[model samples]
Target: MKSSARSRLADRNGPLIPNIDIARPRPYLPRLLKHLFHPVFAFALICAVGCNPNGESASGKRKKERQKTAVVEQRDISFSISVAGEIGPAEQVSVRPEVNGRISELPVDIGDKVKSGDLLFALDDKDLQIELETRRTEIASANLEIRKAKQELDVADQEVELDLRRDSITRAKLEQQKAKDDHARNKILFDDELISKEVMQSVESAYELAKNAVLQAERNLQLSQERFRKAKERARTNYELATNAVLKAQRNLELTQDRLSETRIVAPFDCTVLTRSISAVGQAVSGSGGFNSGTEVMTIANLNEMIIDAHVNQADITRLSADMEVDVAVEAVIGLTVKGRVERIAPKATVRSGIKGFGARILLISVDARIQPGMTAKISIPVVSAENALSVPLAAVFTEQEGRYVYVVVDGVYEQRAVEVGVSDYRFAEILSGLNAGETVSLEMPGEDAEVKEMPAEKDKGKRG
Candidate 1:
């Protein structure tokens, strides 16, 4: 009998087998097998299986694929502006000979270290020596002339005194003549018999003596006056000529001495000799020399200190100052970076390739021995550094009408969030506000096909329940 059936199945010929065995169970296995394999039962069993009809797996995958996101976290952020420049000596000069002559001696060679006043080269001073001796001789001769001039001046003074004496004699002769005239009148009165004999004799003697003295004075005065005039003329002429000779001698001496000093080339400051162009003992060089402006005997520079001449964009100039620290990396020195500070910034901008830039000088605080001039250096100027700041990949941030923003995933849905940005770099940007840490943000726009769809309120409630 079938399990669903309460009686045993009977065959067309009689019972194919006994309906029941008294010591065993009824023969219902065949009926039970047939019932279990019925189409309706199979349909009901297949339909009740745990297989999903809503494509929950596909929906889950779509939800995960809807967006690629990163968690917001705190990190140290910094900004820098890169510029190209060349390394050079802090102080450099082209050594030149101060005097025009053949180089007599060159004591210092290329790459030689030198101190202030150290000898680098010498000029042939034979001509200068001869000129110097000549000047010395001229000075000695000038001294003799000066003495002779002084002596003549003294003689001229005596002549002037003699001339005055001669003038006094002329005046005395006139007074004597008047006294003789008075004496002649008194003698006439005494001779007329009205005057005393003593008065007549006294007048006669005085007049005679005065007349004799006048004659002698006139002769002496004429000779002395003529002698003084000639002496004074000669003395004045000699003194002036002697004074001029002395001055000329002194000037020539100084010129010759200055030329002699120029023969030895001295180092203006402590430096390293970079190059030497003159080596032969007799190569003539001029201070302002041929082909090139002044003969450049050698090039010397202070190697202990170095500077970088960099071109900075005008837009970034405001962020730099003399005290601002900089990072310098020389291309020739691999993996080497040195610290430096801004030493100067050009006030005017230079136009290059239609862009404006300012020239800047960066002084290396501690220079390395390996660092040389003319190396190309890439410098990084520090702008700002923010520690423990909220930042995201630069790609994650976007700008729209609402301003800077990022896509945040909320309930598997992308929501636009506005953010305030601060310092930034090539890799990331700092978020100042409008966002919190640990929030997930989308790197790019999410595809609509991969997005999760929200159901109605009733359906959602039912699904939750």
Candidate 2:
């Protein structure tokens, strides 16, 4: 009956402990293990050990019981703020054509270093050349017209001189005087009755004829003078017109030459090509106009001088000023560092990356060839620094209604003392007064039961007053 009951129990439940042979001597067992062999009892034990009313565990409680303190000592303390910036050339320029034309020759391309006056690209000059020849031809034609007008002017002057000759008028006057003498002598003979009436009448008629001839000569001379004046004026006007045409043609020629020269674009300074927009030869570009800046052919920059554009946090901007030296590290180049100086700071604040900051430009004092534009870099700006100053960990300082204070350790007791603080950094604060070197201060607030006392600094101030 006992063997049947034990088999039924073993079948109903899984084995909790390894089974021992009944034939062999029974092994010794620990009392706890013997009790834990019961499944219900083992589960209760685990619950009692792990479950607690307080949230903290055993290790956490022990860690809280330890007091944290720091020793005040004279040490070198410094603080620096770092900001990310982008590397760029100090002087960058976008090259554009001044006159519209197709690019014929592109000598330099992206990444090419060029000097001032070096040819960068050229435009198709065949059309401009043909236009230039046309302008020259116009100028030559104008010169010929000018020469023809000058010859006509000379002829007009000669005609005026010839018209001024008094030969016909003088001959007419001489004939009129001879006819008057003959008329007078014939009248005297007729008065003496020694001449025929018909002869006298003929003499009178001759005198009248001579007078009409003189009048005609005078009118002809005056008419010729007027005609000569008009001809001379017309000739002068034609000459002036010809000269003006020549001037206009010359100006056109100069304009054509200027346009032709614009076909060849050259570098304005020593620079590196930052970008190239002209992909191939024969790319047509437009000239700058009233509303257009023209097509950009390329971008060049003075890579020898570089600058870092960074936005400094508003909290740290006040501590920075122009000409302040800083350290720059390139993100792309490992272990590369260079010196820089603050060149300018923005007068107003701007938002970048959801952060309000002031723009700052740092000129790289030490330029490296590997440093390229658009590369990201970090700039370290020194804000506050101290050397060999009495300092303590920042945690030791506390703020309350009384002011900044630290809990100093004295004779195994906590002393609440007021402190005058100076410059500070992330991990430490410089103690300007009310604290001395080789002093011990608590990092955390002391318990209420701990012996606490106020330092005699207040009393000392009273006595000094």
Candidate 3:
């Protein structure tokens, strides 16, 4: 082994070492060979397995394949706004009684589907029915009295006509004058002894009787005129009274009928009853009149048309309006997605947890039987979307006190460049200025002596599970 070491050394430097004695190996030779040759073997093994075939370090290979970033390219970008909301019915109402009375029948129970004008509850209406009947009878009596009064007026008018015929003063005067002439002729005949005394007396008596008949007829006519006037006044007053009574009775009947109609509590629209508080058959209810709030019988909801009331941040409210498209997901119904549109954005803002936001209603376009009220809904609204715009990954965009910027790989070097950023959907941001299309950006900083791999940065990472 000694001569082999000398010959190997002589090969490198000729005649550098002199001849040495051929002796047995030393005691520490094993340890020396172990240490020396072990390093050489380890170096050969490392060259075979540990380093790249091209003589690059393992870390250099890793640097070559390190996570590369995306480029600022002209691509259609849609910035979405995420807000949490709950699914609810488009219409909900609490039912109450309109007339105060004892509940006679509560036919509809909880979870019962009902249509408009369907009877849900009934109140005791016996009193109203009796009152209506009494009003009707009064109306009949008034009509009968009106007929009687009209007949009395007719009789009074006929008597007035009879009196006018019997009391003619001019005819009475003519008869009296003729009687006087006849009596005077008879007296003259008696004085000349041509006629008897009884004849003149008889003529005078007939004239006097005719005159008295005329006076009695005139007096009877005056009395008949006064009586007829009084009868006419009385008849007019009685007819007016009867007609007014009829009007009053009719008004009363109408009021009673209105009250009777109130006794029936009908559904205002097609809905499903959610709750019912009234149970006993004889339970009392109150009317929603004056200051009374009335009793709540049940809660009814229209579940056919569902909506999601999403409270959006006030900062994003300006971008929302009527008919904005949206996507909705319900946790209760996994893997089911429904499309919707914004119905309205509330004018007023609501404060919750110190955050002020406007409530936006998203009306579901599709109807499903499995949908129910009060389900948690996740709403996605795309507020700002730009087509064929330069965009970059969000991680590449860094914020500073002045503005936003990104590290772009220019000439194989990371160049910190200023950039103008527009809307961001948390995964990618639209680049407005200070960056051009096809400019490569870095997701991470490479080491001082390392090369950056040209791998693309992942997009839409937030959407992944």
Expressed as tens digits, the lDDT of each residue in 113-204 for candidate 2 is 99999999998989889999999999999999999999999998886554444677888899999999999999999999999999999999
Native-structure RMSD, model 2: 18.8
Alpha-carbon error at 91 in model 1, in Å? 1.9
| TM-scores for all predictions | 0.67, 0.73, 0.66
TM-score of 3: 0.66
Highest TM-score against the true fold, candidate: 2
CA RMSD, predictions in order: 25.4, 18.8, 20.6
Candidate 1 CA-lDDT value: 0.75
Best by lDDT: 2
- For model 3, residues 294-391, the per-residue Cα lDDT tens digits are 98888999988899988888877886779977888887998877888999898899997787999888999996787888888888766556677677
Off by over 4 Å in 1: 1-71, 160-186, 189-223, 226-230, 289-293, 395-421, 433-465
Clashes within 3 Å, all models in order: 1, 0, 1
Candidate 3 Cα errors over 4 Å, as ranges? 1-75, 82-88, 160-177, 183-209, 289-291, 307-317, 326-362, 367-371, 374-381, 388-390, 399-423, 431-441, 447-465
The digit string of per-residue lDDT tens for model 1 on 290-311 reads: 4557788999999999999888
